[model samples]
Target: MAHDILISGIRRWARLPVAGRIAIVYLLARLITTGLLLLAAHASTPQSRFGLSPSMGQLVLGWDAQWYWWVAENGYPSQLPLTESGEVAENSWAFMPVYAFLAKGAGLGEWGAGALLVSLVAGFFGCLVLHRLLRDRIGSSAAMWAVTFFACGPLAALFQVGYAEALFVLLLLIALDLVLRRRYAPLYLVLPVMGFTRPGILAFALFLGLHGILRWMRRRAEPLPARHIVHIVALGAFATVIGFAWQAIAAVVTGNPSAYLSTELAWRRNWLTDPSAQFVPFEGFVRGAEFWMGQAGLPSWSGWLLLIVLVAGAAALLLRSPHVRRLGPEIRLWSASYLLYLLAVFFPQSSTLRLLLPLTPLWGALAVPRSRLYRWGMLGLCLLAQWIWILCMYGLAQTFWQVP
Candidate 1:
């Protein structure tokens, strides 16, 4: 009788409108994340960045949240700060203005509260959009399961934090949905906001280009229109311009041509053998591979081999995996382009997983399996991973490697 009652309740829930279902899922996920955060705060030591028994505000506003808050309080510097050795130090230029300014405009009295409000709201809407993005490609049940995975995934803490990721992802999903629907007009507005919200717009621009090529190749069967051709080209150009606009703004404001690049490289310096190394496309990962491998007492060549294997594996998954193919081509193209963008610019480090949050669309592939045991097992693993991440990043933040 109890089992029947529980199944009936779940069936009723499944009948709810998509928005209602997503809202419930998002709320429950936030509650779980909140509980985990409280546990982490309880376990925090004196050596942790927030110290023992830190408040929820402290946990939310810690790490990069402080940087966003700083940007909100004081706009980017006209003259950049320099280290004792005269290299460009970490400054506000590394953070974009959209999330900070939006939080400030919330008028919540405190920046952290406003930032949290924005993140929570954006994350909820992001889940709704994600469900819509996947519903047609996969079945509704599978899509909902994918949404659950994303909401409760290891990086779920992002939904409650002050970081721009939640906002950036919301905008990204809208932009991608627009692209998939072939509605390019709305993207003009979305692209600028997304570009300013975070550093992933270039990948979107690249995806547009790749998408155009794919469409062109399939024109015989799909009937590509001239108007679409124009929209694709124009939108790609506009996205590229917006992508580089931040760098140009930083350079003009700071009166230094390399202000943004120098500031970004400052963070990478800590991991580089040569602190003064100039920015080189596709070099960061190669260097990062060697650096991490050397730290592990492995041959540098092994790192290169591992990098190659990882790249090939990712390619095989996107191009050949039946599960990923079910998501269709646009998602695969976006994932490939974003990974390429990361390889070109980012150094592998503690923040790598956080940086990969934009790939949330791929969660659909993981949810494609229909076995209840498999689904529940994946959920258990995700929750366990979430606990470990919070423990290291917030609870015991005593080491340099514990950074989020």
Candidate 2:
């Protein structure tokens, strides 16, 4: 009788709208994640951070979350903290202030709990915005599939954590949605706040510039409106300027103009080249690939070859697939720009997949036209992988390699 009721309830939920179904699935995933966290906490030492009556807030406030919380409660140090070697320690400058600052402003007694709440709410609405953007291109069912795949994928567990991804994604989606609708004035307002969230503003600006250029070329014979061109240029310039806002603020505060960039690039210096003293995109990935190859007992050449081949194959598929081709130019360009930003700037670390959450829209292309067996199999693997991520990333108390 209980099994029958469970099946009936699921069938009823499946009949809901795309956003509704996604919300239901997301809540279930959260429940499972929280249960796992509690069990792990029970098994941990009494003095461990996760031990005893672990709640959502306590479990999710790990790694970078702590950094954000620190910035929220104590504020950035007047001078950047440095290691014995005169390099900056993992300080607050590396994290953006949007989410943390908002939490601080709310005067939440426990910043971590506030951060977790912000992430949860932002993640849910982010999905709805994504779905709304997708509905016009693909049908509602396909859009629902995209949201489901994203919210339940292997890395979906990160959405529940007190990370910046949920907020970041929400802002970007809002900006993109506005741009697509030709709502320039509102977009101008969102650009600065969006830029304050992360360096993704750079990718977004590139998308706008490239998109505008293509439009100009197509209408070269006809005289385009000067006001339209001005708006386009203004949008691009706004995003570019805002992208540097935090770094400029940090430089002023530290009285060291190079403080922000120097601290950020320091992490890459260890692997790429010490004393390099600048940000070079893709350098981190190259260094990381070499290090990982050595750990896997594989030749460096083999690793490079494999990475190149895989990237090439994925590009080819995206270009050739009819589903991908059907996507609007703005969506295509944004995905391309964001992927390049990742390859160039982001280190291929344990947190890499979590970083790729912004690429959620692209998953819509693959979600459509798949067999039930294939879809279910992929979801099962993703769910199983989530547990492994929790175990290796958070459950263990030792010197875990992955930062999550």
Candidate 3:
């Protein structure tokens, strides 16, 4: 696996050179992140609380991580459909099947267990990937900072708890960096992995397609580059094929093209601004309008922050140096994916912050230019917002997805 290869490479490449400093710093950041995650799990444990105290064993092992476990153990159970709680216990409902597949084959615990295992594995590798990405664009010191901010930042709290985002970001960042390097085939390979990692990946296909079109248009007087067009078409086609393949198989087995959707929770994130969706949207409004308005605004402050960070990241990419400008395609692909997420997912909530996690390391590297005070302040703000978002979403999300 690339993870193993990266660890080996880091050891040799960083042992006798200036790169060693960044390597040490990056490893230290990973340690800090790991420590903080363990501490958070232990400190706020249900054990300290009353009857509802969390099963500390499950806390570290895998219980809150159960949904993914169920999916992997069961493997897209069509007959079961939605569980009594209106939760889908199938592969589709679990969102990403690759992790589940890996977990299942490895004899990991159920989906949650597998997710937890993968989360840890992914988080560690994620730091390494972040270090590599930033090292190329921002030099060693800033690269170390970028890696640190990601693993130790507030988001680390939730990310370490066996969630998909941690693993997902590792793939996204690595793949994006590959794209920036113009390693087209490798990027394409990562693109499919990303596509399966999360539904939001569809945007990447569109972004790549757009880039190819723009490039061709800019050079229309010259003959079209077959390789460029092929890459774009191939990327888009792969995304579509995998997508329909899943739905087609599920539909054949379940008698519903959208069997996974039907099997999932009743939450119906169907793009409708339901009164059920918002996070106290009614608190600030009048009678009828206020309730639905708040419902629509369930994401509240965090949503706006996501928009700002995304825009800021995009702007930063454009204004960067020529060497840095090489990053344009990667940035646009990530930006497009996030934008698709913002639009496709109705009633965005704090969890939406998960979607923004990959962008942190890159943005952290970019912060090297600003004053230290401002950079630290901005980091603080992002961390605070992430904290608030975790609190709000963790407690509230279960409302939509129930456990057996």
Rank ordering of all candidates by TM-score, starting from the highest: 1, 2, 3
Could you tally the backbone clashes for each prediction?
0, 1, 10
| Shift of residue 80 alpha carbon in model 3, Å | 5.0
lDDT of 1 by residue, 4-82 (tens): 9999998999789999998998999999999999999999989888898999999889999999999999899999999
Best by lDDT: 1
**Of models 2 and 3, which has the larger TM-score?**
2
Would you list the C-alpha lDDT of every candidate in the order shown?
Answer: 0.92, 0.74, 0.54
What is the Cα root-mean-square deviation between model 2 and the actual structure? 3.4
lDDT of 3 by residue, 72-93 (tens): 6666655644545554434345
Output the number of the TM-score-best candidate. Answer: 1
Candidates sorted by lDDT, descending order? Answer: 1, 2, 3
Candidate 1 versus truth, CA RMSD in Å, comes to 1.0
Model 1 ranges with Cα > 4 A deviation? none
Candidate 2 yields a Cα-based lDDT of: 0.74
**In model 3, which regions exceed 4 Å deviation?**
1-27, 30-57, 60-64, 80-92, 105-114, 217-225, 263-265, 269-292, 295-329, 358-366, 375-404
